[model samples]
Target chain A: MNPIRWLVGRFPTLALARRNLSRATLRSALAVTAVVIGVVAIGAIGMGGEAFKQDQLEAYEGFGGTATVEPASYIEEGNLTNTELSDGDVDRIRQAAGSATVLSVHEPTDALVQTQSGTLLFRAQINGLANPGEFYETRNGTIPDNWRQTVVIGSRIADQNDLEPGDRLRVNVSDEFDRNFEIAAVLRPQGFSAPLGADRTVFVPTSQFESGGYEQVIVRVDTRTGSIDGASQAIEQEFNAREQVVRVEQVQEQREQFTEFFSTVNQFLIGVGAISLLVAAVTIANTMLMSAIERESEIGVLRAYGYPKRAVVSLLVAESTILGVVGAVVGAPIAVGIGMAVNQLLLGDPLAFTAVGIQYVGLGVAFGVVTALVAGLYPAWKAANKRPVEALD
Target chain B: MAPAPGDDGVTADVTGGTVPTDEIIRGTDVVKEYETGGQTVRALKGVDFGIAPADFVAVVGPSGSGKSTLLNLLGLLDVATSGDVRLRGEDVSTFTDREQTRKRKETIGFVFQSFYLIPTLTALENVEMPRMLDRTPTQTRERATQLLERVGLGDRLDHYPDELSGGQKQRVAIARSLINDPDILLADEPTGNLDRDTGDRILELFDELRTDENVAVVTVTHDDYVAEAADRVVTLIDGRVRETEDRRANFEEGPDT
Candidate 1:
C-alpha cells in the first residue's frame, strides 16, 4: 500500500488536519515561517559559538607540551623574599624532568638598541641557553650548533627595528657593558601561550649572563613520548617540596581554562537563542487559536457526526505539528550552512563543525517541535470541549 | 398519537406506555432548558417523539418552538435535561461520552441546514468522513464512491464544497450521512438553503432512501412542501407538541380525495 494512503487509513484525522491547514495557505505559511526563524536562531547561534570556541582552542595548541618554572615570592619574617633559581635547582629540575630539555632563562633587562630611527630603549626579555635550537624555531635563519656571541631577535622586536638575520645591532646594557652583536636569526612568533613572552625577547649565549642565578627554567617535554603534566609535577616536587621555592605553570592548564570559559559563553548564547523560540511559540499559539475559532461550525459538524473530542484535538494538534516539523527540517540544513560560513570565516575551515555544534542543531529541531506542541494544546482543548449545539449555533 | 405499524413490522407508541422493539429512536417527555444571562429558559417542554425504520417524519414549527431541540435530542447530539432519550431501547443518558460517540457514529447520521460539508475536503472525502472516524477509510472508499454515484455526484466527486453548488453540497451531505448505514438520518432543514427545484429533488432523494434503502429520515423544517411529503408530521408550538398528522394515508388515498 502507498504510505500516505496507509497513514490516512490509520490516522484519518491527519488527513483532515492537512487539508484544513491547506485551506488557509497564507496563514499557515506565516506560522511555519515563524517556526523556521526560531529554529535558525537557536541552531545558528549554537553552531557559531562552537566554531568560535574551536578557533580559540586551536590557538592553544602546540603550547601544551611546555611548562615554565619560575621563582615564587614568599614572606620571610617581615620582608618579601624573592629568590632566583640557582644552577643546583636547574640540575634537580633536569633530574626530575626525565628526558625533558631544561633551559634556564636570565632576568629580563632594559637595553638600548640601535635602530634605523636611532637608538631606542625598551625592556627586552633575555634567554641564554646552551642549546636554543631545541626550544625555538627561526623564521629566517638557523640556530648554530655551538654557543656564540651572536644573538637572535624575537619577531616583534625584529619587525619594529627592521632587523633580521645577518643584521648588526648594538646593545647597551649599561655604560660598562655596551657591545655590537650580529643578529643570527629572527625567531618565529610563538602565540599568546608562549612561556616568557618570547615574541618580544632577545636570545644570547650563557656567557652574556655569567653573573647571577637563573630567573626561570623552561622544560620542553618530548610531546611524542613524554607528558607535560608529569614533567611539571616532578619539577614542582623537586624544587618546592620542602619550601615555597618555585611555581610550576603548565601551558596545558591555560588551555583547559580557556576551554571552560568558552563553554560557559556558548551556553549563554544558546540561552539567548531560546528566547526567540519562545516568541515563535506565542505566534503559533495565536495562529492555532484563531484557526480554532474560525472552524467552530465545521467542528460542530464533526462532533455531531460522532467524532470524539480526542479526534478533534488530534486534528488541530496535527496541523501545528506539521508546521513544526516542516520548519525544523528546513531550518536544520540552513543552520548547518550558517555554521559552515561561521567556521570558514573564523577558523578558515568550512567543515570544522564540532560534534557539539551538530548536537545543538538537533536540539533546536526538538525545541521547535516541542514549542509548537505546547502552544497548540490550549487551542485544541478549548475547541474540542465546545458543545456541538453551541458551536453549530 | 401512536405510530401505526409499517410494512417492515416497526411500530412506536408515542403515548408513553410500552417501548416498541423496532423503533430506531424515541424521545419520551424530553425537556431541555438553558441558562441565559442568569435566567433559565425552557426550550423543550415534554415532547414525545419517535421514528421507526423506513419512516419519514417531518418536524415543523415556528422559530423557538423547540423543533431543533427535539431533533437534537433524537439525534443524540444533546442530552435531555429531565427526560429519557433512547436509542434502540437503550437510554442515551446512561452511556459514557465515548460510548455515546460510538453509538452515535454507528446508529445515527446527521445533515445540517448549512450542509456542513468540510470546505477543505472533496465530496468523496466528505462522504468517507464517518467511516474515517472508525479508522476504516480504505474499507469505505469503494462504498463512498458508490454513494456519490448514487447521489448523482460521481463526476463531481473530486470537487470541494466551495466549488460545489448549494444543491450539490446537500447531495454530498446526504451521501455522507449514508456512509455509516445508520438506521436514523436526522436532518435539520435539509432543503432550507436550496431553490424550489433543488429542494424537490432532495425530497425525492429522501423518499427514495425511505422506500429503497429502508432508512428512517427525520427532517426538521419550516417548509410546507417538506412537511406535506413526509409519512408523518409532528408540529410543535411553544415547546410542546401541538399536533401529529399521518400524511401517508392521504398519499395512499390519492390527491382528489
Candidate 2:
C-alpha cells in the first residue's frame, strides 16, 4: 500500500494502543522498564567490547612482527635473564632469513661504570652493542669507524651524566678485563627497546665481548618482500638443524593470540547479557496476557461493532509493540552511558562516539521488539477467539 | 392506501402499518441452547418471528424470559441452535463468522442498557467507530456528526463517556447505532439506567427514528412505557412467544401520532 493509505489504516490501531497503555499506567510502565533493563544489558556489553578492541588495536598499531631469536636456556617465565648467542648463529640467521636484517643484542645487566679520572659516577648503568647505530639513532656525533675502545650512551643517560661524544668512561667488564672506553655516539632515548634496560645502556664493539658470546639475535623481516612467518620458520629450522636450542618470538603470532583471547571473553559476556533479555520476554508476555484478560468487555464491544478478529489481534499486538519501542528508546542512551563508564575506568580512554555504536543500538531494539511480538502472540489470539456474547455478559 | 400482498394470502396496510414487501428480518423456529455446568438449558424454543422495515417492536417479559437471548440472536451476535435467520430474504444461518460480522455491519446496529460506549473515546469517535470498521466512504464523519445532532448530542461531540450523564451516554449510543444507516436497530434495555423522564425522552428519539430513518427497531425492554409506545409488543415466556399485541390498533387514528 502507499504511505498515506497505510498511515490512515494504522492510525486507529495506534491511537487505541496509546490509550490502552495510558489507561493502565503502572502496568505499562513496569513492562517498559523490564524491556529497558534487557536492552541496556545487551547494548552496553556489546559496545564495551567494541571500544576495548579499538583501544588495543590503537596501542599496537606500528609495532610489526619483528622476530626475536634467543637461546632456550632454563629461564622461568617473566624472568629476563641473559642467555648466550654465537657469532656463527648470527651469520647463519642472516643467510637463512633471506633479505632480513640481523643484529646482535648484548646484555650485561646492571654493570656500574665510572669516569676516566677515577671520579665516581653515580647511577651509571652500562650495556654493550656491536653496531649501536643500527639499534638506535645517534643524537650528536657520528659512530667512529675504528671504535676499538668507544661506547655509546643512551639519551637519558647522556642527559643524566653530562657526558658527550669523545668523553672517556671506564667499565668493569670483568675483574681483570676492566677497560676505559671513549663515548662513541650518544644515542636517542629508547624506552623498553630490548625488553630490558635500553635507556641507561652503553654500546661497545663485539671485540670487547668476543669470548662472552652474544645474548640474543634480533631478526627484522621486510614484510613487503617476505612474510614474517616464513622468515621465522627459516631461522627456527636453521637452529634446529644445527642442534642449537633456541626460541623464536614472532610478534604477529603473539598479537593473534591476544586478539583471540579478547574475542572469547567478549562472547561470554554477551551471552550472560542475553539471559536478562530472556527474563524480559517472559515479563512482557505475562503483562500482555493480563491486559487482554482485563479488557474482555471492551473487546466484546469492539466485536459487536463488527471489528474482525484480525483487527482485534492487531490492536493488542500494536500495544505491546509500542511498549517495546518505548523501552528501547529509553534504554539505548543509558547503555551508552554505562559503556562510556566502563571504557573510562578500565580502558583509560572513552571511545569516541562513532556510527558503530548505532548498529549495536539497532540490534538491541530489534531484540526487544521481536521478543514482545513473540510473547504477545498467544494472548492476542485468545482475545480474538473470545465469544462476543459471553464476553459482553 | 391499498394492502400489500403477504405470503399467507393475508394483507398488510402500507400507509400507517406494516409494509409486507419490506420484510427486513425473519426468524423461523430459532432455538438457542446453553451448556452450563454439564447441563443443557434452553433459552429460545422454536420461535418464529419477523419484522418489517420502519417497524417498532418491543420484546417484553419477566426476568428469565430469554428476552436478551432473542435480541442477541436477532442482532447476529450469536448463532441459533437450529433454525434459519434471514435478513432481507438472504439466509444468515449458513453464513460464516466473518460473513456474519459483515452482514451485521451492513444491516444491524445495537444499543445496550449500559450504553457500551468505549470509555476512552469521545462522543464523535464512538459514533464513527462502526463506519470506520466497515471502511465506509469519507462521508462517514459528516454522517456521524448529523446523527449525533439528531440525537440531541450536537454540543457534546468531544465529551468522553465518563463525562456524560446516563441519559447523555445513551443518546450517544443511539447516535452510534445510526452511523452505518443499518436497516435494523437492536436495543437491549437501552434506558434501563435512566430516570423516568430521561427514559421517556430516549423513547421519543426511538419513535422519531422509526418514522424518520425508516429503521426496523427491535428493543427488549421491561418498561411499560416502551411497550405502550411500540407499534407491536412480542411477550415471551418460557423461551416461547406467549403473546403478541399490536398496540397500533388501539390508536389506529389517534391524533397524537
The numbered model that scores best in lDDT is 1
- Stretches off by above 4 angstroms in model 2 are A1-10, A68-227, A241-249, A340-357, B1-21, B133-138, B247-257
Model 2 / residue B132 / CA error / Å: 3.3
Give per-residue CA lDDT, model 1, range A217-254, as digits (tens): 88888799999889988887887789877999887787
lDDT of each residue in A241-295, candidate 2, tens digit only: 6765788887556567767887788778877777777887888889889998888
Interface RMSD of 2: 2.6
Residues B1-257, candidate 1: write the lDDT tens digits.
Answer: 22323434544354436556877777676778989999988888776666778788888889998888777787787898987777888889998878888888888889888888888788998999877867666679889999899889999989989999989999999999999888888998988878999898888888777777778888999889888887788888878777678542111111111
Docking class of 1: medium
Worst 10 residues of 2 chain A by lDDT: A189-198
- Clash pairs, model 2 backbone: none
Give the Å error, residue A172, model 1. 16
lDDT on C-alpha atoms for all candidate structures: 0.81, 0.75
Q: What C-alpha lDDT, on a 0 to 100 scale, does residue A191 get in candidate 1?
A: 51
**TM-score, structure 1 vs. true:** 0.81
CAPRI-style class, candidate 2:
acceptable
lDDT of 2 at B31: 81
Q: How far off is residue B203 in model 2, in Å?
A: 0.7
